[model samples]
Target: MTRLFNEPSQFADELVKGFVAANSQWVRPVAGGVVRRAPTVEGQTAVVVGGGSGHYPAFGGIVGPGLAHGAAMGNLFASPSAQQVHSVAVAAENRGGVLLTFGNYAGDVLNFATAEARLNSEGIVTRTVVVTDDISSAPVGQEHKRRGIAGDLTVFKAAAAAAEAGYSLDEVVRVATEANDRTRSIGVAFSGCTLPGQTEPLFTVPAGRMAVGMGIHGEPGIAETDVPTANELAELLVSSLLAELPPSIATAQDARAAVILNGLGSVKYEELFVVYGRVAELLEAAGITVVEPEVGELVTSFDMAGVSLTLFWLNDELEGFWRAGADTPAYKKGRVGSPSSASTAASTADTQSFAEADRLTLAAETAASLPTELPDSSDASRDAALAIADAIEAIAEVIDEHADELGRIDAVAGDGDHGIGMQRGSRAAATAARSAALNGAGALSALSLAGDAWADRAGGTSGALWGLALQSVGAALGNTTEVTGSAVATGVSDAVSGIQSFGKAVVGDKTMVDAMVPFTERLSREVNAGGDLVTSWRAAAEVATAAAAGTADLLPRMGRARPHAEKSLGTPDAGAHSFALIVVRVGEVLASRHSEFA
Candidate 1:
């Protein structure tokens, strides 16, 4: 199974049991299965929150002295029932009554509303606060329709403090609503996730590609495009938030804001900070002053690979209550800053560039001095190597068509998109190689240019590895005019060794090396036997194909997909499959060009 859990249904029960057991000082279980009841302070109203599980420390972990008074939890990425919400509220409710807050989802909306009615019928007053902070969920005029995400913490803290300061349920609701009204959040996913015990993830995000508006759970997003750098991601998120936030809120109280950079698990803290650092830059550029910046797992989607941003518009009263001290195991009170008394001067630098005025001027004299071809044309082996490189470039189109399928395969056992990344890299290599060939550059020059372009187009562990292979092959055949079978064998052997050294994967590790090893072995054997280049490469392609198929029996021992990396006992490695295809197509091209070598 792809999931790391033992039993799917029992996951919720076991996790909740452990949570309540570990946190008995502040939390207790409701009579039903999911909700964990947490005690609120005396003279303070109760703050009730509920949402699906998996996104922990969120709906549940925040239940404490200064945050949520109680939390109703559900199965992984599933909503709690009305009964679960009511039961938890019963335990959490004190003399001040309960203030209900939850993410805006249909299931959560219905279930929490039903629980509110049940509580009202029992003479226990309750007020509701719904969080709709995701900017992609609705347009500016319809902000109420957005999804509540990392912004929940801002709302919860604002509401919890109101209740702690002895505000009535209605007033507590008002404070939280104000916070939610001014809040905006947006997220991007580098990859998607799986629920416990599920063989397949709910959806797949293509590798090296990112979905801009990915929901907290499995809901689809607005757009998918090439993955942007951390700086680019920060700009996109911050700019969108600035555009969507209320004008009054932006200008209110010196336009001060609280920025929360939340990691949805799997993403390292270092990467989160890299993104956060850029977010601070963009926010400052937009004239938005940030208060205490929060960076941590305030919310998560159980090993989901993504990050989100939330902005809370700060007001005087909310600021005062936020600064008030509170004691909780998972949460600590934040100190509010004194409003800036001085007017700061901002700078205006023109950022537009003039591209046409900056063209390089290379003289015809220098161009004439450069070699049109290599110095020597004696070695037939050099031509054979060039022939193989040319053929690999020719068939890049077929690989591009299979990008979607490769992504699907990756989604099954790894971050889907290996195919997309490979196709993109291959096509770029082909274009670069073809351009150099058309310019009449020698074999090594064309191959070297292709290798560099491949690396530039495909970024990530595997892409860089494959680019290394191409670079090694290019360098091995450098300045050689004619190519032969032995020279081709030497280039393949060196390229395989270089890629292996960099990737650090041995045979049976379920990586590209599995296919590369056999292909190089076949090439060396044919060279020693004095066979033609076509016959040698064809034999090598067959070995590569068999080695790729043989990888199905080996378990994955490398890459980030290790923990849940199941025994891929019947499927070929995506990298290995691509390598095998390149080998076969290159061999075919060599067979048609035997006269050139002879």
Candidate 2:
């Protein structure tokens, strides 16, 4: 469980601030995340790596001369938005092209691919090599389906080293892709991690048992069994990886590989060393040689009692790149160069008086931006906008009631941050909607502002999708119009279209689309039949509730749940359930204000 935090929603922002203050010598604050304080060589391709926070020394902690030029940090267990990645790419561009590399997750894929396209349109050459190295996530001959874990380090290092050696963007991407193709990783956890301010763990391992193949974001394991002896555990890990050798390795014998024994948060150094001892013997017995193996905590989930093993098969070129020097804030190898100017005694001469103020100013400047200008509105529109605020209040209240339960559902096969993400997004949306309504904004402007706040504050797939839904609705009901049942129904239908297009999920994907599609269709039919807003919403909410409940019998075909599809059976899709829950509450709110759209 998490204990120390001022505000749960602000945890990611606060930690980044503290990290920059302490590691100013290696990194400086950027709009989205962090970048190296030290300058880089001219015309060197920039390597930008990032994902969600909580996994330290992965995204931000590896920003340095011989590593990534910048990192785009996201909320805890959530991928950074496309805008966040773009910000970091812009900051790191140095006349050469940009290479974005990170773990392969659904949100990260959507966000980073969007950023890559955006950068290309602006005449900046950008490419990506998504790391998919976790052997347990997918079966043989389906390596592309695997997710990245501790192996993120290997791919990021390969790209950075290539860039440091002045490789072109195309060559850097090639090297990183090859590194990812060769890397294999597997992880196991003794217990689950708890999110900040949460009362319980996302999912728990039974006492005297261990979970195999759990994800860093608290995704439940694919298999669980009684705890094994240290030697037995090492044998399991080693044998599992050995069964699926990389295509680059013709045989295991006499092959050299870069090895990493990663401790996920609470696992200590001595324990890792003990595990590595047996791992080394197993490799030696098979005639496989290990080179420059790292045994420590590199990538981590906050306080997760787990360990992961990564093997990066080394060819001649890869071995050279793997041994390259890097000097980040957390992870370090051989000396990259002289200490950065930020670390000089001269720079620290006045550390007492201005440090705290500087930190505060940096945090303010780095905060995510929100929309400010409100659209034109009339008196009637302003009155109608009040309903939007009331509806958001109801949504927030319902989420507050069932957040823990939503987390549990998500933990069945997902990262288990759905509840926390929704809590932050809804609270921010409610505040924004209320302020907009009070300030004379119309339904269009009020809802749009709230959408911006939700997406910016929450920073996840759910946040982005929900924000898009609000914006789509608000766009349909432009300011200064007479609000009607037909208009509201049309808005929801438009939202369904936009969400499907943006998220690339279809009706039977076992996502929110399953329930949202039904709700929108029913609402459109009811409105077409001359039903009032309250009546139509109530009818739609009922349909949504049943559809959401029906998702329990289906297997997920999209997002994080796809890898652990079987584990998610008998549990409703958290996104669908939350969406249905919100609409049901909104229907109740509309019933009280039934005369507004009459």
Candidate 2: the clashing residue pairs are none
Give RMSD (Å) of candidate 2 vs. truth. Answer: 3.0
Error of 2 at 544 (Å): 2.0
* Per-residue accuracy of model 1 over 1-598 as CA lDDT, tens digit each: 2355655445665787677656544454553332222334565788888776778777767766666777887545545656567767776787788888988875567557767998999988887889998887667788766778999988888898888778888899889988888788988887667666444564568879988777776455677889988898888888777776665563533477888999887787999899999998887877777888889888888778888898888878876655665444456665422111110121222101111111111133224323465433234434544554567566576576665555555544554546645665677778767766555555576667676556534434455566667777766666455655776688789988887766678897888899999899988998799888788889889999999878777777765233224535566677787787777777777788776553
Please give the lDDT score at residue 5 for candidate 1: 60
Q: Estimate each model's TM-score.
A: 0.55, 0.90
State the lDDT of candidate 2 residue by residue for 1-598, as single tens digits. 7899987767888999899888777777776698877777778999999999889977899898788899999888998877778888887889899999988888888878888998999999999999998887778888887888999999999989999999999999999999999999999999888788777676678899999998887665569888888888889888988888997788999999899999999999999999999999999998998989999999999889999999899999989998999888888888788436645553445454235545664566544354456678977778878988999988889998998888879878888888878887898899999988998899999889888777756667888888889999998887898888898999999999999998999988889999999999999999999888898899999999999999999999999887668878989999999999999999998888766564
TM value for model 2: 0.90
The top-ranked prediction according to lDDT is 2
Worst-scoring 10-residue span by lDDT in model 1: 350-359
Go through the candidates in order and give each one's C-alpha lDDT: 0.69, 0.86
lDDT of 1 at 221: 61
Candidate 2: worst-modelled 10 consecutive residues by lDDT: 346-355
**What are the clash counts of all predictions, listed in order?**
11, 0
Error of 1 at 219 (Å): 1.7
